[model samples]
Target chain A: MAETGTSAARSDAWGVWGGNPPRNRGRQPGELETDQLTIAGEQLPSRLILGTGGATSHAALEAAIRASGTGLVTVALRRLDPGAPSLLDVVERCGVRVLPNTAGCYTATEAVRLAHLAREAFDTAWVKLEVIGDEETLLPDAVELVTAAERLVEDGFTVLPYTTDDPIIAQRLADAGCAAVMPLGAPIGSGLGIRNPHNIALIRQKVTVPVILDAGIGTASDAALAMELGCDGVLLASAVTRAEHPARMAEAMRLAVDAGRLAHAAGRIPRRLYATASSPTGGLPW
Target chain B: MQLVVNAVTADVDDAATIADVVRDLAGIAEPRGVAVALNGAVVPKASWAETRPADGDTIDVLTAVQGG
Candidate 1:
């Protein structure tokens, strides 16, 4: 595949990895300088993927996108409202790849059709496939999702499916040729955080492809926890866009993703019921 | 001819093609980043000029918007 003009700059921005030469030297084992987030042969600079949704204005959204340092952002397809500000223009100006989504589709067929439309509109075969089962919960219809993912994959799309936390479903999506499986930490926009970290870890273990935690991130810590739980990346919208200060929150989320990834790479200490003294107990007088 | 564009019924010229609908009816002067769906199938940009909607056909003219 031909590299986009931004690829070189993006690789530089990422420091190392993703076909870029190693920049960090003399580093301790398990200490990473930077790990590029690669999905479907595309090496993304930042692990943080922003969704251009719920922002007060395009200016605010652009600021958040720039602050987040995301190399990829998601946009949804909708009926063209004449004279409305173009989200594509703003995203293009920010210099990030667009991952157009089938956000409001309810069935596999609908999602498939929408994905085709996105491919034409965006001029990219990458799609964030979302097939909602219910209106109230906005949870994915697993069966429909898998079906759509299969169809999209067969159609030559680099499919990234939004799925449930079930490890089996994650594996199914990966087996169906999805480039990545985006398991929701909780319901979309609930901001409840990762309700089931164990399941997320299980999904991570189940799939060899990239595992991105999508939805239900209330703050930076939630994104950190997702990374800590073994998610390859984090995809969020309302957590930052809906915050009191979108840019500040975006920056915080960016740092949190990096910190959590480093912590995960560094390997944390094991938990125990009994407390262990950090200082020398033998030398301390009672 | 009449067409159902984005669920809105509108009367258009008989020879109006998908390009005309996208430009004139949808009010999108620059159709670079826009896509059109005739009935239910996507009409590619190159074919949009030749693809005409019959009476009562549903034309969905779509563009990118802020969403997750």
Candidate 2:
């Protein structure tokens, strides 16, 4: 397939991988110029990845999706009527890419099976591999997650495994050929933002693959903090969908992600043991 | 013939295809955005008409739902 101008530019942003050179050929006028978030050789314009769950109404969900300006949105498969107002219809209407997730599966087999089903349903090879180990914590089972990631990678799916903040597991998933590794900030939907920022940073430092901070984001600050910690993206659901004003929160999260990305790129000042004056003392004293 | 669809037992014709089962369970002529699995394997859309559910076989019809 011939590469688009945008994708070619993205390939330039991230050097070519796996023997295929990054395509950098086209330039467009007046496009929103920003650093690219390349996942599986694809450039996603927005750093904020939105979730489709927990919206009180379809209107609210649609509004939030629009407000967020996210390039990717996550949806989970469940045993339900296919004729209903499926989330697929909504996301399709919005024109952003849909990422089907294996939300409730516990075993590698279950997650893999669901991923195939989602592939058939969504006609997309991308799967957010989530293997929940514990019911209470909703924590990812690292062992099963690696197994599933390996299997899906072999199956030619773009496997983005949802893993823990542990750097070892993060490395394992990347080694398993996952497109990206998503480490939870905290338990899913706990509103507990970035329980271990250091661990997330460690994972970022350890893996070459993109690190997406998934779950447990309470609000805009949490999303910002994730990006500031060098996360490629943020995957969250309840933080926006379950809020009293979801649309407003969606806009805030969008802005926060941009703000954090800019801040991280601009670089931060070093922590000081003593107070360092922002203004020059000699000039002020005179 | 009896079949368990989404864990609900339902009676259908002996040679019922996955498409038929989906339409029946959803109570709609056209079931949109639904994917089917017979037993433990997904039945692709192209094979839906050819694949028939046998007795004691489980059929799972899934669609996009609100989840994280």
Candidate 3:
């Protein structure tokens, strides 16, 4: 059932998504065994990485995280209100590996400074480097992001670069020693769902590290679609925690990722624009 | 006593809180959006009201970060 509703949703990019000329004759008999989720050198069980932001409130965020069953959670280190909800308390309660992000830095130097401070505070080199080129789409500045990733990697930080789903760019990040390459499915906050599944496929095909389908996931189906497309993981926030039923959506997303993983291993039939009858006919010899 | 806060080793009364240290710094006039860490661990925002600074304890005040 993983590809049942999933194909309908991901049909937008079919021309590109499934257009890859056959590489492997067919999947191996057993399920595809992907490398464990390890950033820098730490191992994580859950491939579906969830973000703890944009929720209605701290309470909602906490519930959604619990529902999602995510072992790695994203936290932003920034100036909060004098009496606003405390990030420390929230992250602590989530009890997940903290991934601090360099979300708004315009330049590599700024990103490095924040990465250092975050490393000092969180005591982890797992930093999400988001150097956006354009503010409107929140797209990654490939040039700046690559520059920052190089520096952070040199400094011993497991830089996770959030970038477009371009194979060449994703390969660059992997070569730069990024623990993982998070190629956005679309824009940062658009929630338009997976806009370019093929690009994500290409990124997955090239990168040796984890390839996370990040951003623009609008609903549970969208997350499932990513996994079915062969991505090792999914990174999203608004789709699950901001929906009318956040907890329900969180549960759905959790299942979606798992189901999709199994499906990818199961191997899907080659998709065709024209449907053909499955039953074999003997040319009506009778 | 004149003290250099967050810049150099400084001096203050025995019971001075982190707020007092930031406010008492020589040139730092504003103390908003600043998180104080006594020694290394962060002092909880709520506990800051009642917590007091001690001698020889390194106090680091970090500014607010703005990112989306």
Candidate 4:
């Protein structure tokens, strides 16, 4: 992975992602120590995963994806013209791995079938499992999500389930042998931006697998915040695709993710209700 | 026999398999990156040659599209 110099963003932050080593030995800094994120043993240099949806045009989508520096991009299955240029064409031109999602599925059967179809179509076993319970909020049905995950795992697919922020569902997904648990920060496309950080933190703390903040991200700050809260990655689409300037927003998201990872490793100071002195108390300037 | 493919009506042979229908619609000898579902259930590629769709069946042929 090429170094982005983002590790130097914070002076107090330890050397992270191949910048410099910490001065002290045996003292851990924070969660991330490297630039690579491993999911199902696939090492990726990028922590920001982009989805190929909601872009106004294929040109914008291609440009934004390339600018984001995302290693993994998602595509969905639908009834499309076989003659038209495919989304995979864009993903391939970008030179990134494809993560197929069962986006419109509402049951385990449909999701499982779609997973199988995706595997055959992409010749890949990595699936982003999404079993939405209803059409209103598009919240995942925890039970169906876990069931589809287990089925896919048994079928030799790397299942990455899109679940709720509830830690219990996260644990269920982990227990079902998922590659990772992607908890929504809020409803899809709501741009709510991590409504319950506490729950996300709890899921991160409990699950042994990587925790990815998947949805409800409105801007770069939301992605950075997810990383700061100890998430392994952020998967977003509309936050960048729907922006006024998609390529620029994509760049911002990339920098934000890197900065957030750096801040997490640098070890943030403890929060206090009272003011603390940054300058010496004995300073004569007073 | 008549069949509905992606909401379009088409005429097919009574003994035509799903593979034949796909070939007719997609204009490919052996289609790649496409999946077929008959009556809401996916028809595996291996079985496409033998799985015949009944008259007036809804055949949904789906492929990868840009999505979040």
Best candidate, TM-score-wise?
A: 1
Regions more than 4 Å wrong, model 1: A1-33, A284-286, B26-29
lDDT of 2 by residue, A91-135 (tens): 877788989999999999999999999998888999999999989
The B-chain TM-score of model 4 reads 0.93
Candidates 1 and 3 compared by TM-score, better number: 1
DockQ of each: 0.77, 0.68, 0.13, 0.61
Ranking by TM-score: 1, 2, 4, 3
lDDT of 3 by residue, B8-29 (tens): 7676887777666656542344
A-chain TM-score in candidate 3? 0.83
Q: What is the lDDT of residue A35 in candidate 4?
A: 59
Q: What TM-score does prediction 4 earn?
A: 0.86
Question: How would you encode candidate 4's per-residue C-alpha lDDT over A156-199 as one tens digit per residue?
Answer: 99999999999998998899899999999999999999999999
lDDT for model 4 comes to 0.87
lDDT for residue A81 in candidate 1, whole number 0-100: 88
lDDT of each: 0.88, 0.86, 0.72, 0.87
Task: Tell me the lDDT of model 1 at B10.
Answer: 93
